[model samples]
Target: MEMLTVLLVVIPLISAPITAIIANRYVAWLITLVTCLALAGLSGVVLHHVISGEVIHYELGGWKPPWGIEYVIDSLNALVAVIVAFIALITVIYGSKSAEKEIHDSQIHLFYAAFQLVILGLLGMALTGDIFNLFVFLEISSLSSYALIAMGQKRQALVASFNYLMAGTLGATFFLLGIGFLYAASGTLNMADIALRFDQFSSMTLVITALLFILIGLALKAAVFPLHSWLPEAYTQAPTMVTVFLASTSTKVAIYVLIRTLYQVFPNTYWEEMLLPGFLLLSGCLGMLYGSYKAIRQVSIKRLLAYSSVAQLGYMVVGVGLNNEAGLIAAIVHMFNHAITKAALFMAAGLVLMRLHTTNLEKLRGAGKTMPWTTGAFALAGLSLIGVPGTAGFISKWYLVQAALEKGNYVVAGTILIASIMAIMYVWKIIETLYFEGPDKLTVHKVGSGKEIVPDLPVATFCCYVMVATCFYFGLYTDIPLEAANTAVEVLFSTGGGQ
Candidate 1:
């Protein structure tokens, strides 16, 4: 089990350099696919152990906690790691055909290399027990992500990457400073150790200062609104597959870090005293409104979804801010729900880009006639995004509404419904364009055989269909995600904070 835990990070970390050195795009793609497959399998095993109530803790270099690097896999992180791995696998499969259209052939190998590194970084962040190590993994992911976004087809990609770099660096710096203050107060870098010693050496000043720094830093990374200036353009311009992977996993992983720090590292007394829950609730409500409003304004499909991500993130954060079992469960379950829902939406958009060569709402008119599979997948996923009953998105929102009302926070409950209505507006824009309007003749294209393609992009559309199915399957099944979330919530409350 320990070997499996270490291998999860090692496989991708090792494969990345090999892919880079090969300099063959196909080989790199193959290596990336294999690596993701292995990771997905390993993550499943880890999750199984976690579900069995075994916490897998491995001390790196034969040194004990507080003295050496450590990897910890509990119910919370195991679920997150599984999400990242499987999503990466799906993206890689879809990218096999989609990336060729968007990325230059010469640079594709390097893109795969960076993609592997991203997997390594996210998994490391999920599994690492040391705060400093989490930062290291965070940088590994951030730096590679910048490169990936910069590889977009448009020149604006460079500007977007630069903006993200600036924001990401500032976030990392804040996170590091928080770690320093935490080390000074607790004299240990291991998360569990910090929690154990928290009350012993923690001063009010150091605790508040550390919490603020960490929270702000991670909020930036998570693209929690007000600090999310880098997100829109970045998501809009990145290569389709890269955007898919990132939209599904990156910000969610950052939020996972915040969850770990609050629930596993800091004592219950610390957060309550800091009034963290109220602060999260207020900020989350604002983000929900702001992001949904902006999403309704977007004409570009990718950009519209990007803003929707901001609003969806607000829903998850609101769940956390409620600071109860239902809230935490909602947050965890939504992390999975939103990841797949957004991945499907983006995958569908990629199909549109492949066929029509644009995601412009006006240009995509009547795409449903030419590409019914893609349009249908998009509609299903969009329904989930709108939190319609009998979809994965509805389940998360249901729990969120229950949690908020349980806390006597009627405003939060109302805000959630309002956000759902706003989601319907933006999602309807794409649907109307795809189905209700006439196609622009200028956007049509033909293959070398002079046959115009219909029901375009089978492979990528299949991937999109897979995602769409999960959105509905999980909605109805409910047992897997609910069980994992319930276990995670139980563990978190057991460790510290109580309702």
Candidate 2:
């Protein structure tokens, strides 16, 4: 079971090179799919083992922690690992036909290779016990993401990638510098070791500076408001599948790191004394309102979703900022729920792009009637985004409201409600476009047939179904995810009892 920890990172890293070497595109995709599936399965097994009271630890090259590299799978990391793997598996399946359409034929294999590397990097970040190792994996994922976004055919794709590169590099550098400060102060690179050693620091200034740098770096990476300028263009111009994967996983990983830092690395007394909780709560509230306001103004469907992501991230931050059991649970649950819902929505959008050759809201007129299933899936995901009753989004919001109320913060509860309404506005915009308007005036070109007809690829449709089913399944029966989230939260706040 301990060895399984290494496999999560090793499998995808190995498969990436193999994918690039493969001659056939189909074979390359097959390799990527198989590897992702294996990762998901392994993650599940590890999660189960952890739940059964096992802590899996693997030392790299047989070197013990505090001296050498180590992988630690606690309840929290295991849950996140499983979520990352599951999302990657779904994205890879969805990428098949979509990639073929959006990317050059000769570059398809390289795309898969980069895709695997991104997954590998995410998993590595989740499982590694060292802060420096986290930065290393962060760069791997960021570089691959830049390449993936640049693969888009849009004229602005290169520009968007370049912008993202600059922002992402700065964020990574800030994070690296913070880690360097901690290592200088604590004389250890291991996260667990640092946690134990952090108490030795008497200088509040050093701690504050380190925390600020890390928080800002992660906020930039997570695209938190005021630092999220790179996201809309990146999402709008990136290949649809790349957008979906990044939307669902990348920022969520950043949030995971934030949680680890706040609840695990820093002392509870330090957090409370600095008023970090209140600060985060205020930032989150502002981000939620700001992101939603921006989202409502977008004409491009992808850009709309991109802005909505900023708002959604704000909700997660609210949960974390609440700094209580209910708040933490809400954050974790929202993280998972949003991932599935957003993935489904993006996949549906990708399908529409396949048929319409455009993601402009006006151009997507009558997609609801022409592509009923895809459009229906989008509507379902949109409802989830709105926190409609019986959807996964509702559960997260429900908990968030409860958390805010528990703290006697009626303002926070009201903010959550207002954010939900804002989400409805943006979501309804797309829904109205799809259902109320007339079909696109342009003739549709058949995929691979050179005929003037709708191009409804089976692979793309299947991908949408997979995502939609996941959204609905997780929404109605919230036991598994809810339970996992609760357990993970328990681990986060157990030691720090709001002191």
Candidate 3:
């Protein structure tokens, strides 16, 4: 089991340099696909173990706890790791074909190497028990992500990557400084050990200062509202596969860090003053409104989805601010739902980009008629984005509403309703452009064979359908995500992580 945990991070890191040295796109794709699948399988085994009420802990160099690097697998992190790995599996499979359109041929293998590095970083961040070790993985993910974004064929992608690099560096610095403060206060860096020491400094000024620093830093990484200036352009200009994987996993891993820092390293009473939750609730609501409004104005399909990501992230954070078991469960559920949902949407966007060579809303007019499979996949993903019944998105919103109502926060409940309505409007725009509008809205052209030659696109279309299928399956079945989320929530609120 411990070996499985180690392999989760190792396989991707090991594959990266090998892919780089080979510089063969097909070979890199195969290596990425196989590694992602293996990771998914390993994550499944870890989830099984954690679900059975046992934690998996691995120590490095025969040292223990605060003395050495450690990886801890509990219900919470194991589930998150599973989400990241599984999404990587789906994205890599789809990217194998989609990359042929968006990425430069010379950079293809390099892109795959960076992609693997990203998976490695995310899994490491999720599994590490040491605060400093998490920071190391955070840097790994952030740096590789910059390279991946820079690989975008568009000139603007370099600017976007630079912006991301600047913002990421600021966030990492804040986090590292906070860790220093925490080490000074607790004399240890292990998460569990730090939690055990919170009581000793409950009244200390430095402890609260560290908490604020860490929270702000992670909120930046998660792209929470005002700190999210770097997100839209970054998501819009990056290559399709880069945007897909980052949207589905990177911010999510950052959120995991925030949750772990709060629930594992801080005492319950630390946040009972209503300051953190109240501010989070405010920022979350603003983010939802802001992201939705921007999304509605986007002409580019990818940019629209990028803003929608901001709003969806707001929903998850809103659950956190609710600060209860149901709230935690809603947050976890939404994280998983949004992962698959957004990935599917991006995959669909990639398919359209592959076929039409663009994602402009106007240019996509009548696309549904010619690309039924891709358009249908987009509609399904759109429905999930809107939180319609029988979709994964609905389940998370339902739990969030219930959690809000439980807290006697009717304003939040109302805000959620408004957000859903706003989401519907954006989704309606996509559908209307794809089907209801006329094809003459944009010029049509043919390249090469004049026979409509985009064979690789069909592979991504199939992958998008697979994503849409899971969105419904998880929505209707409801057992897997619910049980895992419930267990995760129980662990955070109960004595599972320790009082």
Which structure among the candidates has the greatest lDDT?
A: 1
* Cα-lDDT of candidate 3: 0.87
Which is the better candidate, 2 or 3, if ranked by TM-score? Answer: 3
lDDT of 2 by residue, 235-337 (tens): 8899988999999999998998888888878865687778988888888998899989998998888889998999999999999888788998899889889
The superposed Cα distance between candidate 3 and the true structure at residue 143, in angstroms, equals 0.4
Q: Can you list the residue pairs that collide in candidate 3?
A: none
Model 2: lDDT equals 0.85
TM-score of 3: 0.97
Task: Return the TM-score for candidate 2, rounded to 2 decimals.
Answer: 0.96
lDDT score at residue 143, model 2, on the 0-100 scale: 95
Question: Candidate 3 residues 292-377, lDDT tens each?
Answer: 99999999999999999999999988988888888878988898899999999998988877677788887678778767788889
Question: Which residue pairs show backbone clashes in model 1?
Answer: none
Name the lDDT value of residue 342 in candidate 3: 94
Per-model CA lDDT versus the true structure: 0.90, 0.85, 0.87
On the 0 to 100 scale, the lDDT of residue 424 in model 1 is: 95
